[model samples]
Target: MTMIHAPSGPNLEQVRRIVTEIPGPRSRELAARRSSALPAGLVSGSDVYVRAAGGAVVVDVDGNSFIDFGSGIAVTTVGNSAPRVVERVIQQLDSFTHTCFLATPYELYLAVAEELNALTPGDHVKRTALFNTGSEAVENAVKYARAFTGRPSVVTFDHAFHGRTLMTMTMTAKNRPYKQSFGPFAPEVYRAPMPYPYRSPGGADEAFAQFELLVDNQLGADSIACVIVEPILGEGGVIVPPSGFLKRIADACRDRGIVFVADEVQTGIARTGAWFASEHEGIVPDLVVTAKGLAGGLPLGAVTGRAEIMDAAPTGGIGGTYSGNPVSCAAALAVLDTIREEGLIDRAQQIGSKMSSELNSIAAATEVIGDVRGRGAMIAIELVLPGTHIPDPDATARVNRYCQARGLLTLTAGTYGNVLRFLPPLSISDDLLAEGLGILRDAIAVL
Candidate 1:
């Protein structure tokens, strides 16, 4: 298969040029309009309204260009308006927009499912179900797991972010924004200790032991349906579990007859130098949930797993009206094609190496940087008080503001809100990454 190279067009320069303040006059006007027109609950990290984005740079309405390190929160991994994805989506659109996959199934949907079944880890007989968002995929995975195991309790990790849906919000660990006032949540969802190397009371081994004990005593393996975890926690500060931690959990699930679900929403689709983050640990989870970067910029989510587990759901039990829309499926096929043909997995590794090196160098000099962690292109630095490991959310916000002011778009995440996570597109050029990293270094230096 031929690789789809980055599309070239006007204003696609891989350079940052700020013509106005971070939120220029035009953007300010848009923000004002947005405030009145939209709900106050929907908050945006940046005030700049984007006009166009491709490769590494995003151009705002006021003609300011900024290096994009967020990639629309890891949605546009192949870069915005990727040529292959656009072509496929347009072709599918011209053929048909939506017939409602449940009403009239289509070939594109089946094709995307087949691709996912083959691409995800584990060579066992696998099946896939599609949905419109990560939350839907995760919820459906739980449904299938519960149905297959005949259990009521589901286990999730501390600092794990599944989705915004009620059930997923219950699975998540953060309280201020995600969980505050959003109770009472779904029942039978238990939270366990995750192996966060930086903050764990003991180390990964002890964390694993405690997690196993929790499962055995508190939740009881016989009553558990599944254990859901992000191989690398994304919104919870890009926390990567220590080596062998994930495998140990998987083994525990296997020995207990519980379904092991790996939530690869943010770490899949070549964002983590692998098709799925579970591959890093050589663990074959019984069920895998994916979204975010699955369909370029279009919305698509998938649950791929062992055939018996997936088939546990009754007919008409796990579908939506717009599930596996043809247009999104076409985009997903193109994304998979692009990842394989363009060798983006290797590119992600290269990006991760470059980013980790630069960030570690900065951390060595900056006392506020408590830790530098993550794998592949999914990396982050946790900001803390100058002399202690106490979270410094203010410092994190200042760095984000500084980067945004200087034409570098960055994202901040963490359970404590003190982590600056980087998820730059694999399509970003080396020079553009260097420029963005330089801006980040300056932001940290001034702090």
Candidate 2:
């Protein structure tokens, strides 16, 4: 296995020289073209138009280097333009770009699936199907679950984000933006209150009760095919559910013959200090949805599950035209090799500890930081009114603007829109991470 090092070519100094302003003039021009050319629905957080990226810095079209804390919204774990990834992608391009697996199966696709089966939690014989996005993987998980169990209903947690596809949109809980006018969503999807320690009234016990009621009183355990949830809510504000929440959910799903689907889209591929978030609880979910970081920086998604369940769907019933594209598989293989060779999983743990301690210290100085919580490199700080815990979404907005102005890319999440999430590349330099945190602290001080 070869480790991916921050490329020596185009070093940080050269990167800065090329890109200087936040969304430099070229980026602004591109943004104007995008606004005129694309649909309004493809909204972006900031107008930082990127031209190139590697390690922890993204050089926008304008010639400025910004410490990327979002990782292109948690996609590029090994960092954009990871050496090994770029090399493999270039090699794949030389061979062939697209040979749809369903039409003409390829060895690389099977090799990628084999890697997923071996890496995903569980010693059981697992099967994997590759797709283009996290949403498609999630949607297929449900399809397999329903097909395997012959059950129609699926349960998802509140504040959960599955995808933009019709079935997944119904599974998603947020309404304002994701599901607003996309109603008439797929039927048979039910919502359960998430074990959000910050907002849940009676803690995990109450959440469990709600789950049981939804199963026994509303949908019935026998009728439900799967229980899907994000190990740590991603777009819902980097919320870490109670310690035993996942264990309880897994147990209930097991007893009821329902599949426990772990939506690890944003948390998978060593982002959470572990290969998979379920490892934190020592629980092996029936299905795991992986994407974002899986291919280093390529478009790849996967659903790895127990063989019996995965095989239930008839042959030719579950594949996509471009599922398991060869080039993405090559990139995924390099990603796996890079994580193992570079020891990134444990590094994520160390990075989380460093960030948590520093962020907590910063929080103590201000009353606006209502909560700071997360696992591994995936961390967040929720803003609130100084006296009351009422969400201060505006303050969060201000912090984002401030950070962007100072050559740092930050992201905001949470249902109430008051949370600032830090999804920096796991391989970010120590000085850069600390520097970004300092900038964050200074921004908070001014607010």
Candidate 3:
């Protein structure tokens, strides 16, 4: 795919101006109210209450315009309140809101399935099942894999995050926030090593060997049902596996008759400059799960895979009351249209190129940044102690706060919590992008 340097357009002012302290008076009030009304377990990265968001800017209640680098945790890929999405959602709302697709089938649901089946990797006869969240779709995919293979064991990779549900949390490797205390997780799930470019010298051969060892010992070939992994590890600090590693695993799974599942929840929908991150590795998974940005800002997840595998489940096996809400389906169709018509596939790569270049320049000047890595708009900087690879979560927190205070919204991730990840919307203008990068540079300078 081609990477274009020029930005196509934006939905809001490119300027980011801070008129007050980070969490201004209005936000403080909201926080106080939230403390009483909501559970303290619900954590927010920023104290600023978002009043409005457009393009790559999230305006707070105190009128602070913060450059958005998180994209609402990789949602709103088409930009918040995208014109097409708004229009379609409004039209759908005017007609009907919740006719539950399972009880009363709608054309919107079928249209979304068609779009996903056509767009996802591979030319096989594909089928799609939509749900309200990524975790649900992933669980269904697991169920389908078990049913199709008649096997009990399922496998996920290290530093991988599938979802917050019981089964997916078991799939996730992180423990503190996602899995801590959420115990008694689903059984028959196994963990394997994913190739980490910065941490592992394995590249592809070592990754393959690890997989072979895992299959041979922990999980017998005949007992294993499927192996699910992200093409690029998302919350695990935007970890991009080495070249050929993904393809090697895919080939192995194919040969072993074990279904290969690609959890593209965080890296799909043109965020990585491709329709799906699997396209980057030229690997066609048996089942691919997608969410986060699928329905613009609306909640939606789709599991698209080979028709035979998806059809393995019973007729009433995988579905829910709000599986495919009409409004969300309409928003998803619009999101797909925006990506296709506006050439976001190439735009995403362009954003990545620009961010990677800028981030590399920063890394050259400081020891705080140990590695600069990612593909397309999904990028990250792994923070470390000066002159060493030891994780520095405190530094990560400090830098994140600096950016937010200076009117730039950034996010932190990774197993060690030392990664500053960037997920700007594909529509971010060149000026805003540069400004956000400048803020990041200044923040790192202080660190």
Candidate 4:
């Protein structure tokens, strides 16, 4: 087991100049073809045609390279096109592609599950099931909780971004792009106001009261099966709940018979300075859903929980055709090994602290930056109209476009669409981080 602190790689400018026009002429043609072939429903990110990527820089098809602060929306925690990931993926592909864990059980899948059980929060004996996407994992978690608790409803917080599936969409707070035309969503999924201290009514006490009132007036404790929440609201402006909020929720769930399910899809797998963000509050959710960075860049999702509850589903009740695919499991194993070997959890904290400090300094110079909040590497600064809390979505959009033109990749989040989140890979270099922040500062100043 050799330890590796990410290797020295290509410089920022060298990587950017190679990928010329962001999307270049050839890339635009390919995108046009994609538009014809793929449905418009399948939305795509900014058309930065990618050729190759390594460390903090991604080279587009036009040979221009750009510093990646987005990490494909936090999917590539170990960095894009990592050599170790490439080699392992190629080796796994050569060995086999997919055997479908349900049809032919594989060692790697179970191994990954075992690893997740040990790694995720909780000391009790735990069980895990794998899936292909965060939506699937979230849906399965709800199913498992209901089956286990014999309850009818599940509660989710406002402004939370779970996934785009029917059940997950119902769980999510946004409606326009994600749920506008996709509805008539799954029933019995309830939404409660999340504890966003910056805008929450009366702070923690009122937020707790609202949660309790919701439980009392609408969805009672006995009728609820689970309360699914993100440890640190990822797409909800990278909002960090005030201290004791999660603990109180856990206590509420315990007092009743509800399962506490932590939707760690975006905040887990060392993205928030810990192996799992739930650990930050010393809270152990009865069930934990994880994905995104779990398998480095590979598509993998897991639902891990107490053994009895997770096993509540009847025989043949839960399983996917491609659940626990071997190749994905292999990649996940490598990702876990890499995180531990490289001490990425600690690095996430150090990097996030540095980033937050720098951003706060810049925020002091601007009236638009109404708030700076988040935990570990999952940080965001909400933009608002000067002297008011009105969300400045237009300013956010402008900042995003400016970043793209200047060779930096950043993403916007929050219900009001005014938060700029930074989810850079924990493995990103210090110099790259500084340069990306510099670009961001320039963009903000000009805006």
What is every candidate's alpha-carbon RMSD to the true fold? Answer: 4.0, 3.9, 5.0, 4.3
lDDT of 2 by residue, 234-304 (tens): 99999888888889999999998999999999999999999998898877999999999999878899999
Candidate 3 has which clashing residue pairs, if any? Answer: none
Clashing pairs in 1: none
Query: What is candidate 4's lDDT per residue for 211-230, written digit by digit as tens?
Result: 99988777778899999999
The model with the greater TM-score, 1 or 4, is 1
Off by over 4 Å in 3: 1-12
Q: Each prediction's TM-score against the native?
A: 0.97, 0.96, 0.96, 0.95
Two-way TM-score contest, 3 vs 4, winner: 3
lDDT of 1 by residue, 84-142 (tens): 88888889889999999889888999999999999999989999999999999999999
**Model 2 lDDT vs. the true structure?**
0.88
List ranges where model 2 is wrong by over 4 Å: 1-21
lDDT of 3 by residue, 313-413 (tens): 99888899999889999999999999999999999999999999999999999988999999999999999999998999999999999999999999999
Q: How many backbone overlaps does candidate 1 show?
A: 0
Which 10-residue span in candidate 2 carries the lowest summed lDDT? Answer: 1-10
Cand. 1 TM to true fold: 0.97
Cand. 3 Cα-lDDT: 0.90
